[model samples]
Target chain A: MSASATPVALGAARPGLFGFTRAQAVGFLLMLAAIVVLPHVLYPIFLMRILTAALFACAFNLMIGYVGLLSFGHAAFYGMGAYVCAWTLKFWHLDAAAAILLGGLTGGLLGLALGYLAIRRSGIYFAMITLALAQMVYFFCLEAPFTGGEDGIQQVPRGTAFGIFPLHQDMAMYWLVAGIFIAGFLLIHRVIHSPFGQVLKAIRENEPRATSLGYRTMHYKLIAFVISTFLSGIAGATTSVVFGIATLDGVTSARSGDVVLTTLVGGLGTVFGPVVGAIVTTSMENYLAQFGSWVTVTQGAVFVVCVLAFRRGIVGEIAAKLRLSL
Target chain B: MSEILLETHGLTKEFNGFTAVDNVDLQVRAGTIHALIGPNGAGKTTCFNMLTKFLPPTRGRIHFKGRDITGIAPADVARLGLVRSFQISAVFPRLTALENVRLALQRARGNSFDFWRSETALRRYDNRAHQLLFDVGLTGLADTAAGLLAYGQKRALEIATTLALDPEMMLLDEPTAGMTHADVDRIVELIRSIRTGRTILMVEHNLSVVEGLCDTITVLTRGRVLAEGDYATVSRNPEVIAAYLGSDAPELAHA
Candidate 1:
């Protein structure tokens, strides 16, 4: 249509490599290098824990940010992975790779079932349904014979790497955690740039329009939910191996809160936002561990400050200001 | 060419006890510009919603290309080459203009649920998408997000996306609702240019627009069809005139 005035042109550049603009690639590379050398400088176990949490947050972002579905109970998948991985390592004595993958598969199947029910309702209804179902999974985990209730599945063998490395050394286990995190990150990146991901964004932006365009929006949402939950499950599995325990805390509402807080503080939609968020939040908890309950107070303050100061999250604000597609 | 392409029999919709549409039978012949126009609360939108399968009729049936489509989903109806544009501009605001059109083209090609492949394969659609955007006069704004586009430009984007569907028939609801004079004139040209091989059904309020563009007009009042015929014949009907401007005796004009 010929309007009196023409529209302005902004953000016309094509993104590079998996929806990351050139600037985003640079940011990602810098972060990658920092993490690669992180163990030498900081404690390997502490760094490994943060990496695991970061992967979980990134998985959560894929649902809430790209798909526009706020899942407040991501612990269902994360804890499912932890419980399965721990049980397999303790009882079945499976290899680390197989055990972690089994955990991710469990998450996928659970996501498929839960997504079928949760996606039936949207907005607050969708969130409440997921929270309620996740609580059911939590109860199952608490009462299950293998999980050991209060003690959890303790001393989960990290297991050997394809009959090779025993994964007994802390650095060796750190690499395993790092590898899983990197794999999850790359998979999410690939998915976000795929044609399927485009449909997901379309559904997010205006679902009614997308439906009118002949897309079965529900199917797209389900697939995205499965992918996100599967990745999150992997992160949880990796965490149990790193800590040698998969406690009830892993599947609790508190864990879900941690992932949500991490995603928001880092950035909701930015590709690198979750990592930044995970690092900042994990560092705060680690450094303030001596303060006991004050850690929760500090995290709440951080969330408030983040919401007040940078609603787009740190990386999101930067990406918008720079016109980069991060 | 004179055969009916879409027909509805006694289509009615009731929200609670209030009747939004009541026992309306309608038909659209192939390759004609049919306009649906009524005053506010005349059930034009409700009727259009039923035609597009956006809302189910309480007690009626819809036939599209001779297929029973009353129970079909809106997306399935579009898949059958029947497409409807929204009264509100429904472009994905965060996506770039090219990406929006590209997404429509992809859907038209039945590419939904295909996420395993890299999006680089979508580059094959670039030339056609760029052409569609260019036809809509969005030459350099391809990379701009739809939300950043001006109001008129967003409407143009909506048209381009609908056009990407390449429908045999288009159901456009208020294609020029909030446009300026210049924009309205431009959209009229677009509508005229697009109708060489496709049929169009539209809902319009601007009588001049109806008179200038529509080959046939259906006038409604209070959930019932008042008159249906060529624009000149319908406009001259005294009942149509009174129902619009307010009837003197109020005898519940034609239905």
Candidate 2:
């Protein structure tokens, strides 16, 4: 490789907490404050469920936003992680952290296999390939012996952290999930601002040019896909532990669509968009559960509005208006 | 004679039954501007594409710096010190001109996979990218997004990006195809001033620009080399003159 070093400096230093823009820091802090205080104000178990889903949405955004890939079947990895965690806890009697790690490993392996094939195509083809693969997994989960057919692996034991602290209480589980969510969120942020993330963006913007510039665009894409899936697995594993069940619902196409909806409602490419989007969408779904098919119709309307007038999503529009890269 | 930095032996490319590039041979010596000129559809761009590994040749071999590069991936070919600029501008439109050049520099340095460090800490690369922008007369527009740049400025930024690769050979396909006279002059001057110790093979439709910039010229007709020499000799060749008689050839034949 030619050692022609050229540093490109554009824009001023971002001023805020942890090198984030002011708005991003403020938004994150506000969300953190809410999560910290929500248990006292609302049902702790419900808040924990929303937080778990939010983490998954953020993980999904890591792929969709930074890598510019729309995966319609992320539920494959999420559902797989949930099943693996439930099985391990129910049979192997593993601790919570170990179960989550095992779930991440399962997701990572699947990502490696699926991403290798999915990255071979681009745009709508990539999305379709992932959806097809996820559907295959969904069928496998429904028929698999360990998954218990329709009943799934029920009454999954909520093992302790390293077999030390008890994870029996909802508050303890909430803190643990919150910690994992923040870490995963920060890791995704770090990856995006890193050189690797820049290459992904370059590939997203112009794959041909990126390839001509000597980047193995496929390799980058696969790596991003794996990381996104791994984080989604973490979220799934946490959900299985907290809720004490792993069901086929986790693997359903609707669940996959739900994550996409959350990311879209928040912002497709913006960093913190998925987090906010997850909380809002999950809360809306909870409140609208009694409305029957109207929830689906309302979600569709939101997607249409976001695509038409607010293509940038809530966070994207704000970032664009401020001339800040979120 | 200068050392040959790039050589192709009977390179051929066929799409279905039609030959896009047929039995083409090329030699580019180090540190010289070699111009490839031909009528439209005469396979000039196809030849450039093959040379850059963008299109796989149906037959024959390409030797760059004495290594067989035929059938290699385009990215690997670029890493071997060969780079090409596109006929239409190919750049990250959302990225600033400086970021585009920086990306090239990052690739050149092989540090693009570093996921832990802040991009701003890549001071050496930033300085070099800035210098490249300055060299391409785009320092003033460094912060401008490539999509927002003027037509001429976008082209200039593309050149800056190509330069950041520090290739041993540069292939420019129709570098001045859609430019005003002033923009053409600026590009020609920029190409002339680049002293990166690399050979430049350019396909140019602007005869005057090629005449002024090229050390040697190859003219093609119907995917065959009809004439090869400096401007004066090829301009007067009978076959070259006959090739120019075809309709719509005047635009490419003007000196």
Candidate 3:
């Protein structure tokens, strides 16, 4: 094969440990440093908001970016995680870690069932199936007696961390939220670089070919979906703990759209794009909250700009221009 | 050799009210190169698809390696050692050439679900992937993405990736379709090199390629077999000539 035969960047992958390109390693360190200092420089709750949303977007990206799936109902997992965590923490009185784990497990189970059905279809139909299933989940939450309907599960207790550290303090809760976000972020990286991730990419790029090559493409897709949903659940559960509420907004379509915006704003397939996108989007929402309905218009404007000026999204454009993979 | 590697009986496919493939019986022997040739709309592709389990035959029984595999998924067919290539050169476009081959190798190893292990664990197949690439003249393009490769290189990469599976029987669906003569010759040689120990069932158009590479030929017309023999015998068959090559008899004869 000739050098000219290969396309640049996306296709011209250089060898790395666990799939980290040189730019990815550098980007990871920068993100680490920023997170360590972020709480001190910014409002802790607001920063936590960004962290939670960031993790959600990153998990969404694993399905969107690596697996070439566009899930319109990801908020289903996120919201479900939040409700499960809140219920477990408040009623069952489980430790924080156990609650989060249980929340993830709940999301995974939901994913397994939904993914089985969704993986039966592809393209727009697949997206619709997920969205419909998520809407059904939303209605379930509404009618369920435990969710408290309109009021939601308010004042969700942060409870004890390993029965020692108190999470009642907002500052104390921030660390756990940040830690979960960071761990999820790194885990996504590990996954995208794994053999399973490779298969996901193969299925994403060309499904029929992957199948002809002896791959159980549907099974691989279901597993990827479950993993993505599990992580999204963890992010949602963490956010519910920090914010002390599990409401309809958690599973709403609008929330689902927000993660899509954040992922797109950062860069769909770029490694660090979703985190950066989350920060940018969260900051923009906070800055524009007083503007009321104008916030949606402003978001529309951003989407317009992103599509027209930067089809690859911010991080994607940067990675393409720099000949790097972040 | 008398051993049958793949045999399909009463294979039929109907699209709504139109019959695409009529009841057809096809047999492929082990360690031989077999070709399915016919005119357009003769259901050659539909037959190949049914044989490879990409399409369910309206009525058929397909046996591979002496096991009834009718209605099996393509993945299962592949596991049974009968892998089919697409009409177009199918590959994971965004992945590097090496990654494309490595995926096939990993799939063959029954470890595609190992999500926790780093891809470095796949490095064990790197040497073999490189060798396969080298075999198809794509060694230097290993790191290049499959989509970015030139058209001819893409076909070569596809073959290299398919070879990574170490299949007992291979299916080539128009392996050289839309290729320059130079590229076509390269594939013909590549196919020949891999045919020594394994069985091959191919659907091909270019008569010269089918003539040069295939050990036996099955000619189809109107979704049914018209002639079955060596290339020379099939080419001379009055029915094969009238139904398919009559208009291009001189051209085919020259080929």
Candidate 4:
């Protein structure tokens, strides 16, 4: 058992550009090219909706995918972000950037309050805790005076982003939404690859092992939860800005389920999976809306198929095929 | 005499009125290999968990480096230079072996909250991580995902990751519980190589390995210390023979 007697094969790891394998880098470029060109081929408003959903799903993935925490009430942050952003934009007359930032802050603050309690219990209990907390927020929105009871905040102004670029034009608003989506996507990517992200992965892999290595697992989980909710907040804020309305529909428990389905279909833990899943699921709802109640049935079928056929989701499967970490 | 590095006073644990570990006192000397050996349900693991602060003792005081640590958090205990490994191989299965070692070494960077900084910042630890791997005979498997490593190799990797902390003392739970003769010998050699300047307290099932490596042995049975001494002295104790060795007493004495 001498050290010299051990086998000496070099590892199979390959260097990549910007931490992405060749395949991932190519996929990223293709996705970016589509982002830029899609406005010309498709409706910009519809695309903006997809971008918001994409960002929301990516933020949700930070919990379930990276940290192995299934947050059942993520829509609480998303819906609250929308309500806050809409309130600021309509009443306070804040600029787009400020409104979105405030929305994210609201989500982060709310996440801190709920996550402190939720992370104390793990697995299904954690999920139940989050769901219960989010439901409370949903009821608060329903009864709150500022939330307009059933109507929500309507006719939200899409003012200039940073008070310079006019966001009244559909293209201008689309660009703003696109910019937010990309920046949020990269930020999530950066967090997942950072030293902090490394600890999160270790905690996700074996929590007791990480604790034995001197990591405060609770603190790490709390921080990750806040960051995730903050991102979800902005995604919600962006959606309201794009649509000019913040409705009860956005805060419904169904929205929480929708985000989960989006991420699950995209690939639960894959970096790009949530975005792909968001696009697929959001597009399905849009196209299937004519069928009314049948939309839920179709989504249920898709969820069943995805779970049974490819548990890894679309991006997870592709990454597995190519042996990449995307 | 070596200075006492870790000591326990009347350590006890009761789960729903069933006494798991009862009124056990343990003293481990600095810079020595101490083995806690006992038969099945002898409370070796329960006692180890108390020392590591994984389980709170119903009645006990633990002193490490002359400081009481019974009430401290488990992470803080590890930060105080006392680390422990699991009975089961506890590697981060998805992480590459280098990444796993680098994770332990990353603690030296302080307050692992650099979420905004790129992970390439951790590349600086590659040399030290590689060296630790080399010491544990895992250099060849550095790039392998820990889940892919063989059982013996994973145990070796666990030791390497544990060593990355450079702790003053280590508590290993069943380091070679399931290993071939060659793997056991290799681990004994590896343990010996890394024994310098650090104290090791291990719960080992293989008596022969303990005989070869441990400076002192503590034998426990049914949650109580039946005998404590050098291998030759304790193996000859009739109480130990009756309680632990039983039918294998002759072979145990020869070994």
TM-score of the B chain in each candidate versus the native B chain: 0.94, 0.95, 0.96, 0.97
Tens digit per residue, CA lDDT, model 4, B1-255:
999999999999999999989899899999999999888889999999999899999998999999999999999999999999999999988788999999999975663798888888888899999999999988777889887899999999999999999999999999998899999999899889989999999998778889869999999988888899888898888898887656456657778
| DockQ metric for all predictions | 0.58, 0.50, 0.78, 0.58
Model 1 residue-pair collision total? 0
Give the Cα RMSD of candidate 2. Answer: 4.0
lDDT per residue, candidate 1, B126-226, as tens digits?
A: 99999999898898999888989988889889889989989999999998998899999888888898898888999887776777698889988889989
Candidate 2 wrong stretches, greater than 4 Å? A1-19, A320-326, B246-254
Quote the true-contact fraction of every model: 0.68, 0.64, 0.86, 0.71
Clashing residue pairs, backbone N/CA/C < 3 A, model 4: none
Error at B97, model 2, angstroms: 2.0
Worst 10 residues of 1 chain B by lDDT: B246-255
| Candidate 1 local lDDT, A1-326, one digit each (tens) | 01111121234556677666687788878878987898899999999988999999999999987887889889989998999998998889989888889889988889999999999778889888989998998999889888899899898878886678789898998888888888898888878888898899888888889988888788889999999999989988888888879989988988888998999998887688999899999999999999999999999999999888878788777766765656
Off by over 4 Å in 4: A1-15, B247-250
RMSD, one per candidate, in order: 4.0, 4.0, 2.5, 3.9
**Higher-scoring candidate on lDDT, 3 or 4:** 4
The stretch of ten residues in a row with the least summed lDDT in candidate 4 chain B is: B244-253
- In angstroms, how far off is A326's CA in candidate 3? 1.4
Candidate 2 chain A, which ten residues in sequence have the lowest lDDT sum? A1-10
Which candidate comes out best when scored by DockQ?
A: 3
Q: Can you write out model 2's per-residue Cα lDDT over B1-255, one digit (the tens) per residue?
A: 989888999988889899878888888888889999977888999999888888888999999989999978999988998888889888887777878998998888877877665555445787888899998888777777777788888888888898898887788889888999999999989998884576899998778888868988999878777888899898888788778776435754665
lDDT of 3 by residue, A210-288 (tens): 9899888889889989999999999888888888789989889888888989999898877888988998899889999
